[model samples]
Target: MSKWKRLQENSLLLLPSVVLTLALGIYPLLWVLRYMFYDYAGYGNELFIGLDNFRRLMKDTQFWDSVGNTFVFAGGKLLLTIPLSLILAVILNGRLRGRGWLRAIYFMPTVISTAVISVVFYIIFNSYNGMVNQLLLKYHVINAPIDWMGQEHAMLTVILVAVWGAVGNYMLLFLAGLQSIPNDLYESASIDGANATQKFWSITIPMLGPVMQMIVMLAIIASLKGYESIMVMTEGGPIGRTEVMYLYLYKLLFPVSTGSAVDQQIGYGSAVGFATAVIVGIITALYYYLSKKMNKVF
Candidate 1:
């Protein structure tokens, strides 16, 4: 076939995907952006009230509260998950009996459905007659059953469940990065009288710079998308204590809230969604830029 005909055929093959993307993705995004500047409830006429949704969002204390909860959840997950994942990866990367089984067991959680995991964790942390409380009582750790999912401890439970579910995927990623490090470098360190700790600090870490940075960025982004698990597990609270930005956005979209805050404003939801997308974008860019700079130092 002539070159022009070949190009035309390729374009024809790509047309369906392009159209589908526009229909399912780009179109909805544009529609949401349009609604962000108006007062719409997915029904009657949309009032073209300019920027009012965002204005209300700015002063909305509950919205800001959700944002704070979001950061707490995301930060807590990263703090615990990353180190645990790295430790697991390092151990699994070593020569050991039952390594295959161990790796498979650890990585299985990451492959499981988030909803299933969250539901299971939810049951485990139930206030009364739950496994966790039962264990604590068995160990004489507490005299009575503690409310694991109650307002005072809900965020803690969410963070714990998140870390348990999150560690596996990052462990797999770290395992891949660990395996890729050249054996010769370790041999060289061994000959230089370097201890295992010394070699790990000097060689493993420095060489894993890119991988570490990648894991950090991935974990941050993954934690931001923790809505499904949190929703399934907590439904935003014992009293809205576990509400994150996405859950709050959901509440707005449904005209749902703890009484006195309910309003069927799809426009506000869209505004929150837009702001969230922008925040994600900014964090992504900053992470990559910082990673590049740190990689140079390494």
Candidate 2:
């Protein structure tokens, strides 16, 4: 067959997928772009307002609070999850009995539903009858029951749940990266009188740079977009202290009401959504730049 014929056949094979993606993904994004410029309640007439939505976002205090909360969530997850995953990957990469079982145990949480995990954690962190407080009291760690889902501890609790759900997947990624590193490098390092820490710093980390970059990017995006667990556990409650961007947007679009009334602010919600998209885009670009720089250093 001629090269032209082969190309035509390949294009035919890909056409369905391309069409589906445009219909399901690209069109929705275009719709969001349109909504961002319009003042439209979901059921009302949409007014073309140009950059007014963007301007309103600048003065939205709740949007800023949600932004701050998202950062805290992302930062906390990154700090705790990445190092923990690395350590777990390193340990599991070593020669040990029951290694497969240990790896499975670590990864099991990632396969479970986030909503289920959130509900489980809600019960575990209950102020009066939770297992965490009961254990702490039993061990003499605290004199009284602590409210783990309260405003003071809500953010921390959410962070911990995020880390727990994420570490497994990242550990698996690191493990695959670790496996790809040749044993020859470790032998050479050993011959050079390099300690474990030295080998990890000079060899393992540098070799795993690409994998680390991918994991960090995933973790940041996940944390920034976190909602399900927070919704199930705290519902951004205790005076909205744990309200992240997505939750705030959700509430804005589908405002909770009393009795026979409905409250809707579709325009404001669209504004928040657009602002979040901008922030996430900037963050992703920054991550790409930093990853490229780090790759160069490594």
Per-candidate clashes, comma-separated: 0, 0
List per-prediction Cα lDDT, in the order shown: 0.87, 0.88
Q: What clash pairs does model 1 have?
A: none
Local accuracy of candidate 1 as per-residue lDDT tens digits, 1-298: 9999999999999999999999999999999989998888878998898988888988988878888898899999999999999999999999989999998898888889988999898888877878999999999999999988888888998899888887888999999999999999999999999999999999998888879988999999988767777788778887778889888787778744433266677887899999887877788899899888866875
How close is every model to the real structure, measured as TM-score?
0.93, 0.93
Q: What local lDDT does model 1 show for residue 287? A: 83
List the candidate 2 regions with Cα displacement exceeding 4 Å: 256-262
Shift in Å, residue 228, candidate 2: 1.4
Residue by residue across 1-298, what tens digits does model 2's lDDT show?
9999999999999999999999998997788777888888788688989998888889878779888988988899889999999999999999989999999999999999999999999999999999999999999999999889887999999999989999999999999999999999999999999999999999999899888889889888888888888888887777778889988888777766211123676776777887887888889889999889877875
**Distance from true position, residue 293, model 2, in Å?**
2.4
Predicted structure with the largest TM-score when compared to the true one: 1
TM-score of 2: 0.93
